[model samples]
Target: MSEEEFRESGGRNTVFIGRQKPVMSYVLTTLTCLNNSPDVILKARGAAISLAVDVAQITIHRFAPGLRVADIKLGTEQLQSEEGGTRNVSSIEIRLTYPPEGQGEAAKA
Candidate 1:
């Protein structure tokens, strides 16, 4: 799917956190929730998994306490290394869901 389409798809939104600062991911998650999105998925691989977790925590605890973790999926993917060897990298997907009626002031939107 196109990037734009992938972003504005119903109650679901996905944020891929990589080298960017954790604040960036936190802002995106908060905005997604404020925009009436019921679900937000945070994705990261390898070393970035901790960053993804921090984003999820900040979003749920600081920004949107009413939101809750709906699911978590973890796995490893095989990828080709630059040295022409195969490597397995761990990945994590964190799904957060807000209430159907929304949370606090966001409910009006």
Candidate 2:
């Protein structure tokens, strides 16, 4: 989903990982988790996929060990290239879910 659409979903937390530095992505992910969002979706396209993965890892392992990956969806979209030709670009959605109270890491494992 687009950033605007994600934001419009009241209870949903979403982050778009673009070409910016990975550190910035990490910070945003951390903040989202700290905000008590039950689930967070990390979206990235094309070359930014690796950066998105890094952000998710750092957020889960380092920042929020209690969080776990709930699901992942991957696909490609056909877009008009700068050269005016159709091109297929890869996209990914990584969903992280925080366990409910009293569940903790045991439930995740």
Candidate 3:
């Protein structure tokens, strides 16, 4: 699939997390592919540490048992505002890395 298609499909995988899950959709804004792997950087809307965890759990179930907390790196930062006044909002960035493309051969190396 094209990158856009892949991203869209990947986004669908997280739909369950947002549906009926309070503050989940608000917490996660976008999911960007990183380093050409399943590694994704989840851009958050506000300080949503728990929301991020919820997302990771959904991803693990969708992907496989190989998913681990260590593989999913988490971070946060404030967004830049146009005006002088700084907003109270914070963003959580999560880095989720899955296994490489090739499995059998790569495993030996």
Candidate 4:
């Protein structure tokens, strides 16, 4: 979801959507979300699924080693395009649960 959509979700801001940004940027975002909530869900589609995994790993290993991957969900979304009538895209949701002991400072270093 977009930034506006995320805000419009009514206080449900624990989700981080992976995009074509630097891995560290995504890592920071995930850490920020984790600081605010008990769990942060990283969602990505297609090629971004790999990036999402990398962000989760880096956030766990580098910033919050105590963090746990509570769950992982995989699915496919069908989208319609002008050229291609319909195409299937892979999607993944990695749920990183349990905030670090040092909450607010998770992303400081």
> In order, what lDDT does every prediction score?
0.72, 0.75, 0.46, 0.75
Task: Give me the runs in candidate 1 sitting further than 4 Å from their true place.
Answer: 1-12, 33-36, 100-109
On TM-score, the leading prediction is 2
Model 3 C-alpha lDDT per residue in residues 1-109, reported as the tens digit of each score: 2224323644522322233456434334323232234555553434445676677666555544554443433334344457865545443445555666565335768
What would the per-residue lDDT of candidate 4 be over residues 1-109, giving only the tens digit for each residue? 4335434543453555556579999888888877788888887777888888888898899998778888998988776656968777787778888755675345667
* Per-candidate TM-score against the hidden true structure: 0.73, 0.77, 0.41, 0.75
Question: What is candidate 1's lDDT per residue for 9-101, written digit by digit as tens?
Answer: 434477777765756656575556557656778877789889888888888777778877889989887777889998887878888887666
**Model 2 agreement with the true structure over 1-85: per-residue lDDT tens digits:** 4345534643447777778665665557556655876788887789988888888888887777888888998988777777989
- Residue pairs of candidate 1 with colliding backbone atoms: none
Candidate 4: stretches off by over 4 Å: 1-11, 99-109
In terms of lDDT, which candidate is stronger, 1 or 4? 4
| Clash count list over all predictions | 0, 0, 0, 0
Report the error of model 3 at residue 73, Å: 6.6
